[model samples]
Target: MSIVSLSSGEPTCTTEDVKAIAGANGFTITPGSVDETAFLLFANAFDATCEAIENLPEYEDPRLKPVIVDGERQCHRPDAVENPLNAWAHKTTLTIPSAKGPLAGRTIAVKDNVSVAGLPLGLGCSPGLLKDGKHPISPIDAIVVQRILAAGGTIKGTATCENLSMFAVSYTSHSGVVHNAWQPGYATGGSSSGCAALVSIGDVEEARQSGKDTRDYPLGEGVDLAVGGDQGGSIRLPAAYSGIYGLKPTHGLIPYTGIAALNPLIDHTGPMTRTVEDAALMLGVMAGYDGIDPRMTPESPMPDKVPDYARDLQAWIAGKEKAGEWTADGAAKGLRIGILKEAFDVIGLDPAVADVVKAAAERFRSLGADVNEISIPLHKHGAAIWTIAARPMMPHFVAGNPPDLLSHTMPHLQPNKIGQDYFDTLAHRNPAAVNILMNAAHLQLKYGPALARKAHMHVWELRDAYDKALEECDVLLTPCNNTVAPKHPASTAKTEDNPDGCSERIMDLFEPAIGNTLNTCSFNVTGHPAMSMPVGWGKVKEGDGRLPIGMQVVAKRWDEASILKVAKSWEVGGRWTDSR
Candidate 1:
């Protein structure tokens, strides 16, 4: 392409403008003929460069074109009756582009932040916070969405996420609170709340169809699988609480090109499914280098080279069976399992929940695996290091100006200039969003960049610590959440008597999620592959019935196969609910 010609208009800079610009940066321009003339010339060149850039055509990747039909774009905001759990952001069905791939006949839900052409990308924020009270309609498909269509998966709709995907609980989504699939009015851990609920509910329906007793499950319809984003436990937390499988794949294993990102360092998108086999099938199609996102590295397999995980898993089981090694009493004979000692010691951990996870971990011994407790002292500090290193860069991301790191940037999805209106709307729905903005700014002002730099260095150390631990064991096990899903708190909407929109204090809205991601977030920072597997059942703190308890399975970086194998062995042994 030929370069666009620069504008011939007169320079817009003035000596006064130059002085004002320099003054803002704690500097002054000398007011003399020679200095003034030189400064004006320099400023004009900069302006010309910017104008020339604007004149160039916007770049769009030819590989990621959307395939929307004329009438396929029609979508509606489902009513409460249509969406009992309030998990859907919009409901529509897109055409399946293929019919012979591995995911043939499967239904999939995409998270709200992922771009699906011609659909409203709500990002789970209130309409008032969006431009003109409307969410942006995506113009192109995300890389994952493209892969799903090619694999014969029908696009069901966009699933709701937490506000700005900042909270770990489901009640913060602007669509309305998402109730647990197992029990209404209780929490479904988020910000991948909708994906979790949909897949879990789908499992219940499937169980009923197979003549399995589902008298305890609520009535609902859901998709077979879902694509979920994870920054810090968003995907896994919900999976644990809802009795499903959610994987946070090793960083860059799946391209994040068309998804809304919080920070490039920790952003990941993976499968949320009701079965380990389904998770493997979805990952097989999704894992590969797209040549667009900077997050993918040399470690990422090319599209054609991606392993058929579902096939490989079955082959592994078959081989074990042929050798008479996959017996009922020794399904995991060759596996080495480690219980992360510090994961059970986090503050606010429920005694019953801990006991449930402990019992689940010990069950591995019955399968002939070597199960033992392993200690990684630095594990306890991983969350703090992750917070400091990543928080300083988040405000820039929230404002839609992420660092220009040569990735496929999504400028159209960036929000309008943030102001009081944005803050007020976000604070009422989810104070966590506002808190991130303020905390990032405060850290920047007080510590400058040194603190973040130091914390980032510690991130490497933390990774090394976990690496050392994994050297002694194939997989490390930890309780996914400190407790079973809690009851949903009241909304923060402003009321006549409570003008501030808070129950008693501003912190009340966030209190329920304290330390929720203690075990999961560390693996996110370390870039280790982790999966939340439903292990048993634990009682809710405030309720009488039981909720699913999940145990996190962590493997070395890019070793999702190990996670799948370990989870599958336990899965084949029997029902997790029976273990309780």
Candidate 2:
């Protein structure tokens, strides 16, 4: 007689486990005391369990067989044999052409964390999974992947992401450091490291001069679009660092149906691209109620119309679109931008960064838009609120669940089924993952999860403060990051005594990174739309050539049109790209 297992649990249960199980139940079972009689009794019980299992009705498979897309896999890990900046995880070069879609001929790179049916998705941190010689490839295309193909975008490959997508910097990936596309040595704020690098690259002159593939697709240009996930500024941070346009849309505007998320509540998936028009195009095609992702309810907050993002942006920039339905020429002329004073007042914010941002704000004011300095006292607590609100749920992500939309588990971080090396890497110090997890554990142990509950209440206060400010203004403005991209962090070799210290060295990034996230993370909790638009280029270093500086725009929930309108105005005013 065989016992029918209730569910697949721990793969193994040794005799030590049995004793422990008995101990947990307030009983003592000596190692060999139960003897043959107990074994016979257990066998008898298993017979009944098996009989019940056989009598139980069987459940049919719930999932429909997906319409398979024709494609082949071509793995491209440049760190293995080529340049580190070559950030393609797998380049399928697969073209499922659409006859009349808006994104036709655009080149898109899906971040590696997203499923691309047959491409490898490492989540950026696991080394052991790949070393096992059996790569667990995605069998079904993620929802966004399907959207891109349907919209006629040609996928180049899966873009590189930071290791386990834990850090904001590009250096921690197990594959290798993801270098800045603008200035190679400086960091590309991540975990959308590859998405930004690919979008920022301008070596197209060399590619054109070198006479490469320039026919149907053309050469000497960066990617037209890329999809990136944001838990705490992953999409916007890298976009700021690499000098590109990135949007972290309202928490649920885009379906996170098939994405790897850090925390369910704060998780977002958005588009990063070279221009505001392109970003809008990508968003227009991707957002809607997917019938999965519970975040999409009957009352799902969406634009009055869909798929008109780029057209609207074009009209708005040309001074043709209206503010709403009420007035024409109001898209730009009537915009009210609220600049958060505390964002610039961050205690350790770089002075140069502050000055540059202030100048940009003045530019907005001078341009005849209604821009004013507004105060949100609790703005300083954005990062802290995000910390308490997001990190406590990380343990669920650490357990690794996909929390698939079809599975109907929104607002929950599902376990990633892959055998992650999280435990193996635990002995190793990771500036981002280890520190965050350890800190979360300490908080729960010392203060209990009740603190997390209280933090939710505090989140309301933060949101209310921002909402009150937004009521006075259409959007809030701030610097995306305080300084230009910092130099790449130096690596430390694992040593006998300092083995773990090597992982902790990312702590060095805190000084430059801390203030950078203040303005961005709050929106994650507030669930508002935010964007980073490259405004100007400034010296990230003393003598190094100027790199991109991005200004962040935060709008009221579901007001993506206003954000794009302002961004398009800036672009059409001749600040689309640096005059390099």
Candidate 3:
């Protein structure tokens, strides 16, 4: 259709244009404007690859049109073989065979926590702390990583993760804070921050605006891409905040062998990308039986194996697909939706956000989904799920049997490897010292789960309510976060920014933070599949301040087929573009 030509000859907005807009608006664009410019160009390139520009007519402004047009521009040859991030900044690169058949021309950025042979899988931790300073790179690849490679998807590079992929914010020993593509002053959200960063910045839309070379982008737009892992919303959070589609499949549906693990209770390896179709394709590549992970269920099977995710995408896009073709429309369409009153009332949501949630529920009703406000009494105690899961598991992370107590107490658990002399001091400490230490560990192990179980039950009650609601309707819809993205840590100006700043305190301060796990963790804990699809941006004044927001959809366990179907339906209806 020569869509680019059809657009009133208006130049798509690029990073430069955004800068102008920000400057004109009196918003002081952050100091790293150069990197910001480069990132916008990269984001555009990837947007062009997937025909995402065709969807941007709504962006309207002529100058902005050039951003998408320019973002899609490609390099004559691939830059897959070398480290792309090795240039002026701490960029990275990797190589894998291209995606097979329909995805043959596509490229991917793998999560560093997932092993790729001949490359170090540091999981963003220092090399010295690792088992031999190397991931047990399987003689056979991590099932999903190998699958993508087999599908002919090229590996761009390993994305960054929090140490052991524990935290969501992506600060690795190897890579410092990865800047957000939309606004440098903001965060891109992590442990999968690298995937989002590279994908967002790698596109031509972002690159051209920044005036960087097109071929050198980090986040590629067009190709069938995949992301790895989800535990306490690692993949989904980045996907939602960055504006992309992320699927955390039913646990054990996709094999987890060859990937690094923090705690098995919630760890899930999956794909994150720009479209549902690409997510499907990546899922196809990654799914299958691998003897390495006992978690792989022999009974579980990939949903209708296909050679390419693109084949099914056509029917979906045309609206020719049947109503029951996937999960019934997750929107209000005859769906039974539960408004977890506990989830709504308890979480410390931003004031602007509460209004958004209230409004979204109304919108679902407008769409035809049956809405019910239900109360899950346990929702108030939901934060405990993390403690219950991490306490027992944290000890395994200690280097040896008689572990170092200091390691556990560090802010954010950033590992500080101690020599024997330092180790002995703690080991041989007096009874009072030992008593205090033992008491503390006992609290974490004992109290953590109590808190987690309380939270789990509350979430479980919500799930039960959702199931009942689903029995009456189809899907549950909820606001993705309580507040819009918080101010960047750098802006906070704390060199030793307390992880707790973002973790426990602020999370409780906002409604969405605590309740997000309410809707999200149920899917994880129950082994059901769930996805968060972008509906639109929240209110401009305080709700994300123009940042995008998503609506969450959850389906019965192992019913990702339905979740994707309905989620995509809502997406097309809304013209949701996977921005990162």
Candidate 4:
């Protein structure tokens, strides 16, 4: 092939831009004008590079069958907040009309991080930070979104997510601090804040017609289900605090395509619902391989194969009833449950919280299951190793452009500018993001990539340890958080001197995360399916009245069905939840 100079339809590189960019990669450029020979050399390299880039495989869209057309922006409100519970990120109301399916007539709210084609995706970041506006209407729908719409569900709106989906507390959302549905002053336990709140209360207009504010600490009787993504316990945390059932399904079961991924390896999307059955029903629709997501494979569970995971729960309930083994006091015979001592004994766990969770565990024993303490010493170190590994590596994926559009990891990671507006607002609105970014930067600079690489090795060991422990028991139990719905640092009235209680001394980012991360984050990194179900209520020293306490149940890989059965069994038995 001829080394053609100034080839037709080739990418043109400006001299100054080329020099600046090439300098970063250790290339030196002289200020003098280049001769024809040098220009030809540049052209030769450019043409070859273009050929290589063009030759790379393009993403193949799953092209799912639909009532709604693909790539159509069906709902949105640009440059404005939609409503209070929906958050400031973007306001939208959409229902991609579909014929009757399993989830027919069900209303759902999806987290902002998940894409709905033609709807603005704020990703819980400020409008100005994104190039076009606060809510950038997504060009394509995420796999879960398509699945839900196809299953005859109604999408209420795009719910608010924490800024960059980084914080556990709802107050850090880009639109604004989200109000706790249970108590006005308490944290909603985010980044799935809007979904939890809105799903529980029902539609804003309809709830008002029913003479309820919808935001007035209503239970999830109105809306059917909500969807949430978990990179580091986002789904489980919000559901726990909001007193609903939330599951972080085993990673790779649901295609993550079209979601704004914080970490490819850790991301999972699942159902948050008022009832365990609704959660299982939603899971039956959402779980499966979509060809688009690079992470999904043939072995992952498919909804069709396990048709009616929702209905199967009743069969188990019926069997227990037939045996006369099921009583109003207890249900589910011959089940074995293990309570993790490490999660209980973790740093600074509230005694009251521990008591409530323990009572729930003991109920399983009353229900005829052998309940015992299973020790996995490595679990104690999960959070620490997660910090060393997951925390430090997240900024690379979130702040920088990923190598692929679908969820993927950048092997040769390099830090990129996260944009100025993000930091400027995040400093005050989400100090947690500031802390995380700064911590990641510090760790990377201090130990280099070798430290993160070594930390991944520890993560694998932790997963193996958890798997071995599961062999002895069907499920592992833990308190979801040390405190149930702690008063929001920004909004709660604690001292009486300050009604809002958002004073500078009290505005601590790590406080909300203190007890929450110890138990939940371990499952996130290990790709294990874990759930947080509202089991009992307890009063906190920091607040008045009894608050909801969630018990986490983690099952072995692809064993979500087992855990769901257990959760439903305990729920129907009526001893554990009613004891509060």
**What CA root-mean-square deviation does each model show from the true structure?**
3.0, 6.4, 22.4, 5.4
Best by lDDT: 1
**Which candidate would rank higher by TM-score, 1 or 3?**
1
lDDT of model 2, residue 71 = 54
lDDT of 4 by residue, 1-580 (tens): 5455434454465566556666766766665557434654675567666877778864435462223633344564433223534342444445545447888788787888877766677777766655544455555667788888878887766777887788787766655666655565567787888777765553333436676333443233236688898877898888877778899998888878777777776778899988888889998899887656776666685656744678887788788888886774557567879999888988878898889888888888777787889999999989877787777667766665673444432212223357676666567667677777788878867887888888899989999999999999999999887777776665433347743233354357557766577888888878889998988777755756555678999999888988897897786557233565
Would you estimate the TM-scores of all the predictions?
A: 0.93, 0.81, 0.64, 0.84
What shift in Å separates residue 308 of candidate 2 from its native position after superposition? 1.9
Candidate 1 segments exceeding 4 Å error: 1-7, 14-20, 30-37, 68-71, 131-133, 206-219, 492-504
TM-score of 3: 0.64
TM-score winner, 1 or 4: 1
lDDT of 3 by residue, 1-580 (tens): 5434333433355766657756875775564678676545544554464465545432221211111111222222124333232111112233333334444657777777765544455565445554454343222245565566555566555666654554444332233444444444445555576666555553335446666423333433332365757776777766665666777877777877556555455668887877777777777767665544655565666435422335555555444445532222443364456665665664555566656556655555555566777664544544454445444544444333322221111111223343453233222111121233354468665675465456556555645654664564455555555544444443222236543222222322222223444445545554656676555554433234355565666666655666665565555335543322
Best by TM-score: 1
Q: Model 3 Cα displacement at 377 (Å)?
A: 3.4
Assess the local accuracy of residue 357 in candidate 1 as a C-alpha lDDT between 0 and 100: 88
> Per-residue lDDT of 7-115 in model 1, one digit per residue for the tens?
2478887899899989988898788678888777777777788888888977778777896432457788888778888888888887665456888789899999999
Number of colliding residue pairs in model 1: 0
Any residue pairs clashing in model 2, and if so which?
Answer: 124-164, 125-164, 168-190, 204-220, 400-415, 400-416, 401-414, 401-415, 401-416
lDDT of model 2 at position 177: 62
Give the alpha carbon lDDT tens digit for every residue of 1-580 in model 2.
2343432333244456556656776886666666533543454455555666777864322231122444554555544344546466666665665334777888898887887666776677654534343445655566777778777778788887876677787766665567776666677788888888887775333334466424222212347789998888889999988878889988778877666667777888899988788889998988876656766556454534454778877766555433342222232466787888889887666677667666766665544578888999998888888999778877666655444444433212233333335545532334567667787888878998888898899999998999899999988889887788887655433357654224454456444456667778889988989999887767866455567788899988878988887776555345635333
Instruction: Report clash pairs, candidate 1.
Output: none
